[model samples]
Target: MKPFTDGDFIKTVIIQAATRWFPGEDNRRDFMNIVQNTRLSPATITRKVNVMADHVHEQLNIDLKKCVRFSIHLDESTDKTDTAQLVVMIRFVLENGSVQEELLELIPLTRKTTGLDVYLSKKNSILAHEVPLEKLVAVTTDDAPSMTGKITGFSGQCLRDPDFPRFLSFHCIITPRSILWENFKYKNRV
Candidate 1:
C-alpha cells in the first residue's frame, strides 16, 4: 500500500473531525475511532479546519454583496467555554427564489460585555466589519435593555445625516403597541 502523505492524512482527519462537529448523531466512539485511524498530527488537522472555515467565509462575502436587501439578526450568548460572544447572522433572499442565512460573525465581547457604551461600540464595529451599512434593511434582536439601546444607537449613528443609510429595528419579542402603551403610562404617572 502506498504511504499516505502528511497533507492527505491531515485533510482526511480534518474532514472526519468536522463531521463530528456538524449536525449529526453524537457518536463519540465513532469519532474517536476516526481520530485514531488518521495518521496525521493533531496540529495539522486543526490548521486544515481553520483554513476551510476561512475559505467558506471568503466565499460568503462575495455572495452577500449581490443581495438587494438583507436583514441582520444579532444576539449574544455564552458559549461552552463561558465566553460571552456576539453572534451576528444575516438572512437574505437570493436571486434564485431561495432564502439564505450566513453566520456573519462571532465576536468576543471581552471588555464590552458588561458596559453599555463598550457593548454598543463593539456591536457597531462588528456590523461595520461584516455587512455594508447601506445594504442593511432591518435588524432583529431580543428584548434585552442593553441590546435595545445598542440597536437604537446603531440606527442613530447610521442614519445621522442625509447621506447615511436608513435602517430600521424590529424587536422580535416586543410589540410597538405595548411599548407605546408603557411609555404613555410612565408619562402619565410622572
Candidate 2:
C-alpha cells in the first residue's frame, strides 16, 4: 500500500478521537504503531491539531460576529501547576432562535491574577474576535471572590469600564447554595 495519504480520513479520525475523553497515551502509541505503521510524528500531529483548532477558532469568531447579542460565561481556576487559567465561552441565538454555546479561549495568567486584569484581558480577547462590545448581553462567572467582590472583582471592574456594555452579570448556579456555601446548610434545611 502506498502510504495512507488521505487528509480527509486522517482529519476525521483525529476529530473523532479528540472528542473522546479516555485512552492513555501509551494506548494511542500502540494503536498507531500497529495500524498506522509509521505514520505522522508527534510534531506533525501537533501541527495538524493546531490547524484544526485554528479553523474552529475562525469559524467560532465568524459566528460571534453574526450574532446580534451574545452572552459570555467565564471560569478561572489554578491548575496543578499553579497557573491561573481562564476559560471563556459565548452563547448566542442562531438565526432560528436556537441557542448555541461555544468555548472561545483558555487564557493562562503568567502573574498575579486580579479582577481588573481579567476584565481587561477578557475584553481584549472578546473584541479581538470582532464581536461588538455593545452586543454583549450577559456575563456569567462563578462566585469566586475575585469574580464578584464588591470593590475589586471582575464584575465590578467590568461595570466600571466605560466601554463595557451594561450587561446582566450572573454567577454559575451549579448548586442551590452560594459559592462560599453560606446557603448550603440552609438550602438543605439543616
TM values, all candidates:
0.58, 0.69
Off by over 4 Å in 1: 1-39, 80-82, 114-130, 150-164, 174-190
Model 2 clash tally, residue pairs: 0
Q: Which ten residues in a row have the lowest lDDT in candidate 1?
A: 150-159
| lDDT of candidate 2 over 7-117, digit per residue (tens) | 447655864574353367776666655545535655666678889989998888777777778888888878899999988888997666778898888888777778878
Stretches of candidate 2 off by over 4 Å are 1-39, 173-190
The residue-by-residue lDDT of candidate 1 on 1-190, one tens digit each, is 2332365655566667766575555665567567667656557656777899889977787677666677877676678988777777889765675778988877776664543543465456545656555667877765555466643443443444353457787766764656999999999994
TM-score attained by model 2: 0.69
User: Model 1, 70: alpha-carbon shift in Å?
Assistant: 0.8
